[model samples]
Target: MTINPLEYSAASHPGLMRDNNEDCFLSQPEHGLWLVADGMGGHEAGEVASAIVRDTIERETHENPAISLLDTIQHAHATILKSAAQGIGAPGMGSTVVALKSNSESYQVAWVGDSRAYLWTPSREGGRLERLSTDHSYVQMLVETGVIRAEDAEFHPEKNIITQCLGMQELPQVRVDFVEHQWHKDQWILLCSDGLTDEVNDKTIAQILFESNNCLAAVDQLLHAALTGGGRDNITLQIIESPLRDNPLRKGLWQWVPYLTGKTLVDAWIFGAALASLVSILFYVMYF
Candidate 1:
């Protein structure tokens, strides 16, 4: 059966309080892949760690078109470890990652640490906003065990303390989760760094998505909301809108660019390849 083409947009900002942004994201509609990684450490190490995680996963996915999503994340984890050992960044540098991949019939969402994936679908009563991925953070554990109320989690002092991440001194006891669901009309998927959630509330996020004209506008409004709500940390968001597809292979034409990096449409392989190289060089020179 034919399905509708997927539409997506991504944006990232350094936020008001931070001097550098330690977040990286990917939106490859052609390959049905999207990701958000948030790095944690001092100085430029955090950014380097996140970049390594994002680049590694992108390379692995592009090379083996059929690689398992779970395996791909593990590969990224291994690469991050190697980079840290080489002193590319701080010894404790690490990152949290959330990824989404889909086929014609269904989609897969995976993640480690506190980055999140949310699913929104239209309904007869009103649209629904559901958090598809659970956070691997200390406060999340407290909330799960009834030690704290969900409402209080946001203000908890340990809210930013994630239990698992990409790289650490010991081989990370990565607890990756996978969520699989079939596609439907008017369904949208959101991947974001903790910066967005830490600032904008759930209700505000749903309101913005429902009111926005397109996926791109939704991304813009989401970033605006985070900045307006304090913007204490780096903020990033990627929104994927799947209208019911009526064509074979779900092909469409549009430009996909990483907001922080230079623009290169995903359909243009030559330009995209060169841009990828430039990004690596820029990362090494800027941070190292």
Candidate 2:
């Protein structure tokens, strides 16, 4: 059996403006499955929609490990629609979902509506924070058609108007978008709802991820940043790290050696001597 090497952290918040959280997340590192769902509708209906999406995918993926994530999401979509049709939730209830699946060799991301996925690579690996999924929203359409710049879409008046999502009555079938990439030990994958993106920009998110010592810290910092940014809507996020990579902060310590040594030659010599002694002790302990 191939042992899974994945570490992850997740968080969800109701935000400052909402009374209840209509967001849900799933993290099953052993299964290499992660997901985020943002619900739409008034009252408790939105919560019900998101919960259905979360539960359906979770159950389906667990039952059949080899099932495609695309099919799993489609199953969730049908479940949510059926629930609403059967009056389980309010009429017209729906949800946006973004999911990530990975194995020892590669990763795949799938999404619908404005929920998103991102990849962060460390500086040694070309240092990039990339968005892996596109929004299925009115603003995105406007941006694509050249009616508005991509930057302006964030603040567009109809930015929240999604073109597609799970459980929409008018649509007969949901459309899913997907992307695949080779998995690397030095990279991280992020799945999130629009709440975080609506408040925190991508640059700030990249900085937080870069500075964090581990997946848990990264998730905490990202959640704090979103709440600090006004917390206008329900917020949810997940950060998944590659288990093959050592602690990122430890790997990055060498970059701080010069700063730690200070400006003077004497300081550098002292620091070097201390580092050498520490290494000697570690070597002795290991060898003896």
Candidate 3:
């Protein structure tokens, strides 16, 4: 019998002040993995970094029945550099990355930059959401060593300056984590960019998920929460599964491979925006 390995669902939102959104998400139910990346460097450069990460790492799932968490992340790093040299987009752009992969019983994670992964579970003494990745940012370092309080991290001048990211350097920073849980319903998992975590702390995030939280609501509420709390940067969020993973079909081959492709009318709007963004980015990157 083909055992259903993992079952999951997820969502993402682009929050305020980005002319072009550079966030990306990938969920492979069959592989029991979900990824969220928040791109920096702006315009087409940011978009390229994020897209390459999502597409490249996800493609590996098609070949292997089970993906090694370490190998997947390292391959993603190489894929991004290869994409840059292939003449698809600008150079020197980079992005923060967080990825989660689960088996039938346990899970593993990898991270870099300020993006994060959180796990919530119930216990005999109740339950809690715990952050599993370390932020590779200047402010995070300060917070770690007791320089700035967590409350003050938002306004730090270096809050947005990530010390390391996927494409910014030849060697990227990565951390691997293994998380254990009962994989039950109402056990929430969160992956968000600095924009979301910058505006909302762990307590606030847990409260929202505890309240009226589903895929669409979580994305909207997180974006609004960030905006209300100052929204200084681009916010991207992906809340996946209640506890595990599930697969969904992808469609794109039938339509114009070179011309036009998408399901809904709103997708056409996104395409138009992408084209406009591509043109503006060409001038901005080339001239300036």
Writing each residue's lDDT as its tens digit, candidate 2 over 45-69 gives 8889989988998898899999999
Q: Which number leads on TM-score?
A: 2
* Winning candidate number (lDDT): 2
Off by over 4 Å in 2: 1-4, 124-126, 246-288
Candidates ranked by lDDT: 2, 1, 3
Off by over 4 Å in 1: 243-288
Report the alpha-carbon TM-score of model 2 versus the true structure.
0.86
By TM-score rank, best first, the candidates go 2, 1, 3
Candidate 1 residue 85 Cα shift, in angstroms, is 1.0
**CA RMSD per model (angstroms):** 16.8, 6.1, 19.0
Give the range of the ten consecutive residues with the poorest summed lDDT in model 3. 247-256
Task: Write candidate 1's Cα lDDT for 1-288 as tens digits.
Answer: 346667889999999999999999987877889999999886689999899888988888999979988888887888888887888888889999999998666899999999999998854244799999999999999999999999999899989998889986676556689899998876889999999999998899999887775788899999999999999999999998764643432222322323232323433565567789999999999999
Q: Report, for every candidate in turn, its global Cα lDDT versus the true structure.
A: 0.85, 0.87, 0.69
